[model samples]
Target: VQDPKHAKKTARNQLHSGARLLVLGNNVMLYRHLLTLAQAKNHAIYIRDVVNVDKQDDGAAYRLFHSDVLEQMYQNELENNEMQSLFVYLFVLGDLFDSYLNRNIFHKERIIMAMRGYFFLNMWAEYIES
Candidate 1:
């Protein structure tokens, strides 16, 4: 298993240097650890699936290796980061939000913002009650 601290250090150093990282492996633990660290640091990472031609040709079905926990964590981190970007685009770019709305792409953002707002309100309520 890759050390979590080492993975974090590598990811941070790479991002700081504006370099792309390509980790070629099927180690679920390593991927999860790196992704968790990336989420904590508000860093953006993209995952591209690489299909195995050998497996396909061998008549062996291609199956996803990641567990549900890993997939959920990845999706949550991605949506959270996208939500942050949505605000930045709306405030900083000025015209980008209008363009998204014109293309009907704002509906997804509307749902994400509503869900996030609800989550924060629940957290605040719990804090106040406690």
Candidate 2:
């Protein structure tokens, strides 16, 4: 378990050290449970929502996992992958590139897109959401 006071720093260090997968606990107890797991395994951990940072690297590989967000991404990726036709593949790739470009430039659009693309978009959203 993590003390709320230290959650932000713990999360930052974990993220900086290449912790790629994240499971968020919306409440203090859950957060602490996750913290304990991370500590037990000697892995760095971060608490979402409570942590504040000025900026984050655009290319960080970390992914925050939550139920609903995972489902959407899974569905989208599956839908994209299951279309056996080349035309569908091209269209998906084109959409992907376009989304990337829009996200790179437009703050609001990026948040909407990232929210659709991954869980915990807020971690990075703060940078662009401004």
Candidate 3:
């Protein structure tokens, strides 16, 4: 507790502040807005399922949740942000480039690097996977 250098090294080594998916206790967070949205769409999107890997296997493997679930979560988070700038990186903006609406606009050539956004995505995966 008294060692600053060791504390700094530990901080650097840590995976950092985290989000929880409490499968062991079956306590998961369902956002209220997402619940409303799912109800409106007439679909309940459950994130996890128990599936047996093989007939010989004694137990089930918990497959990762569908990409759509993560995408929905990402989209919801991005939408909730005050700036909404994350969409340009998260969602494929390729369609916007082909639209006639964008025909007259000047687009920058590689104005931003995608690695930063990807780093966040990888970091989130670490939170989920680890």
Distance from true location, Cα of 35 in model 2, Å: 46
> 1-130 in candidate 2: lDDT tens per residue?
2432233234434433333433222211122333332333223223332144233422211222222223333444325432222222223322333345543557666555445534333543463445
C-alpha TM-score for every candidate:
0.21, 0.18, 0.22
Stretches of model 2 off by over 4 angstroms after superposition: 1-99, 103-105, 120-130
**1-130: candidate 1 lDDT, tens digit per residue:** 1642333233223322324332222111233443453344433332221121232221111112113323444556435443332222122222222222335547776566546645654654575456
Q: After the best TM-score superposition of candidate 1, give how far the Cα of residue 69 lies from its true spot, in angstroms.
A: 38
lDDT of 3: 0.31
What's the lDDT for candidate 1?
0.33
lDDT of 1 at 49: 18
For candidate 3, write residues 1-130 as lDDT tens digits. 3442332223212211134322211223233433333443332242212121132221111111223433554655445642133233213222221221234444442323234434554665576677
Candidate structures ordered by lDDT, highest first: 2, 1, 3
Error of model 2, residue 29, in angstroms: 39
- Backbone clashes in candidate 3 total 0
